[model samples]
Target: MSAQPAETASGFATEGFDPATATIVAVTYNRSHLLAGLLESIVRMDPKPGHVVVIDNASSDDTTQVVESFRDRLGAELVYRRLQENTGGSGGFSEGMRVAYELGSTWMWLMDDDVEVLPDGLARMGAWAPRFKSIQGRRYDYDGSEFYWQYRVSVPLGIPIPFAPAGFDDAGYRPMNSGCFEGMFIHRDVVRRIGLPDPRFFIYWDDTIYGWLASRVTRSAIVNEFVLKRTREIRQWDMGTRHLNASSNMYRYHIMRNRGIMAHYYRAHGAYRPVYFAIGTAATFVKEIIRLVFVERTVRGTSNLWRGLRDGARIRRDPSFRVMPPLEEAPS
Candidate 1:
């Protein structure tokens, strides 16, 4: 449960980074069963989190009851909030992080309710906290196979390029340009400086942007240590870039819409070279067409693809976007 504190060089200071200073902020929808398993795992984590907050996105299920059951069993302070409306993953995390920050947590570990953390995962992450502002844990499927989470994006084109399957030495880390929220541990300083994630994303691309923002401000890396295990098998649409082909209409709509919105955001902010903008847009179009024919192989999917692209082109950031208040003060 303990290791010698890592010495700090520049970025995050390891001296003040304590396991007890980290708060686990998990967001869930109607998956009470999965949420229960996740909570159980958190309690068993070595050097457990300082506190835990569960953000329920207006689940019609017994999500509230499940969290209540753990209130007494968990080793840390547990707070459960059920929103009046479903704000999707984007909003749920935004609210959860806000609460964690307000509660004075030094680090917020963001995740969904489907994955279980290894007993020593948090401890492992803590060892590297002094060197990086953001640390992502390695993830594996329930079957014990490592998830291909090392995917990177092209510098200017923004296309996904999966890293080659490889091994890492103990305590080794790799610089990351993108990451998922499943096992992302971040310092409160990054949240305070960069601001909360844009809630308007509703679902997709929000985490990627947040990860980029964190990396921009301070050092970030993916810890090669397997600190978490995914309980479910990887789904078909889980493939990078080919995700649109295997997704439902709703998911497809969001993915396409967010892609365009993010593209414009990056361009306007000069995140990438302007010369490659046309190349990136063209590459995306070609990729979708190929996916529709080979992977999706349905006329209906084609229609949805076109519609998503058409509607997505008009997508813009919500000017009224603001971080939601803490659960206690949230409007009815």
Candidate 2:
């Protein structure tokens, strides 16, 4: 949150690569082409994963076709589970984690659909995870190549921090913004306690909320370059546009509604203020305006965000605008 130097993202592999790792679990609703590239890298891991699971969240495209193309090459080594409904990213990720749980993997690597694991992801993250355990409360470069620490409010480089640690190192461990997700290889035992990410967060911030919780139960903060993520991607697009286009309905519905929901906890009890949340709550409205007037000239998506905010202000239970299980593990 403080003014820090621009992050060094390019050299993460060499300066921070870790090569010893195990199974990885990823989710993809579509874009099997992109996923195939990631899966290919996983197979080449040094200590190959005992299992790799991909939960297809009802993708309309030839996603299954894409995955199947690689079946013979990866064998049962890669397991694919096609879903019946599109519950959203939270659901998709939860389903993948559930599969990882069933496999009894010591660790589960979490990856996004549009992201690619660095060539040395497994070995790098695996190696750093332990070395990280030694330092405790600190983050290492993806391949154990570099370490980044929070100086005042900004994170800067220290030395090369190993990706993983063999034993617990309570030195400077901090849970990630979203605890462990976004290409995180989680420990099995931790799952039994924490369960999967909160299913309520349908569109965004599920990770941030999860990190707050994880901080209470474990030390999980980290900065790794084990994977290269397309940080920005469209969940949907209107007739035409380069920017992500959301349904006028969902924008009004989930994105807007979830703002108040997240603020209730994140701001009130989770350390946020209503005023700040209000300012943030307005961002969606602003973006929608820009899209309508400048970027895409679309009124539908922006309108939906308004409707979502209206509904969100009424929410008191879980802030996210979603209908999911109260808090339960996905079926195995």
Candidate 3:
């Protein structure tokens, strides 16, 4: 795609900021059906990405064949890697970003296999490239309603700013202290400064911490433009202002277990609030319990909550837990 000149004085130079310099990095595990839809959406992107990197997490399905079916279909270069074991979303994204960076991509668009990019999604996000180093476009749920939680992130509480106005500024963007990897369009410099998403998380909160770290070094924000459409359908509880989706037992466990990882990041960044985090953690457990009993209509996996909390408390001392360097220090 041809580059457009920056329209504002505060905007950086737009040279080399087009989609041709961007790489779409996606991770999938046994979701060939969903992956095929995402790949098909890429085939329809207005200005295609420079490269497409798909990290297969050892799926015992037709994922390889599905990706192969699109080999010659995509105008952009396609690179596929199938790991021997399932390393989950964190590992897949880490490896995908590493490959994209080594490929010399100026921008890396990170997402899962479940969402399809809008035809103009890449183009719309690119329009803001000259102004923000880290950017996230809007997303639509399966029913075509806007995903409301992508607006603002409260770095101190380590969650989306609750009850914050969902509207964007007059500039059509809202400043964000956190990021969602689902459709995050980030510059290479941010990656270099913050390093890849910590794989130890293996599932949840990795994106939150990664986005928070990116915010420390750049103008991170979520633009008021829809760029992705989620294809997966899940039961959601509408709370008037926000919606809480039902989650799986595995995700519930990670949501609790990963608090230690979040605490580590917060402490590393000097933003850890023991009292506040503890309160928040307690509140989260209560909400999950309610979701299980009422929304999910079962209490089968309640034990995971306690087990995860116990593991989370002890995880800080685990020798394998990674401690990221300060943002000022360049990534090793």
Output the number of the lDDT-best candidate. 3
lDDT values, one for every candidate: 0.74, 0.54, 0.85
* Cα deviation of 283, candidate 3, in Å: 1.6
Show the colliding residue pairs in model 3: none
Give the residue spans of candidate 1 off by over 4 A: 1-16, 163-166, 169-171, 237-246, 272-275, 281-299, 316-332
Whichever of 1 and 3 has more TM-score, that candidate is: 3
TM-score, candidate 1, is 0.83
Scanning candidate 3 in windows of ten residues, the lowest lDDT window is 5-14
* Comparing 2 and 3 on TM-score, the stronger one: 3
Per-residue accuracy of model 2 over 52-126 as CA lDDT, tens digit each: 788888999988888877776652377889999876777777878777777766667776766555544554455
lDDT of 3 at 162: 72
> Please, what are the lDDT tens digits per residue for candidate 1 over residues 1-332?
44345442223223445777899999999999999999999878767788999999999999999999999888999988899999989899989998999989988999999899887777778877878888888887767766666435665775555454455666597777665788889988888767787677788777877787677768888877788888765334445422332446666566666766566557545675655754765676666666555566754665665676676666634444233222343234
lDDT-based ranking: 3, 1, 2
Lowest lDDT 10-mer window, candidate 1?
A: 321-330
Q: Which tens-of-lDDT digit does each residue in 1-332 have in candidate 3?
A: 56665332323234535677999999999999999999999988777889999999999999999999999998899999999999999999999998999999999999999999988777788888889999989899898888876456666566666777788768898788787789888998888888888888899888888888888889898888898999999898877658778888898898889988898888877998888888778877887998897778899888899988989989855757666653346646
Better structure of 1 and 2 per TM-score: 1
Reference-based TM-score, model 3: 0.92
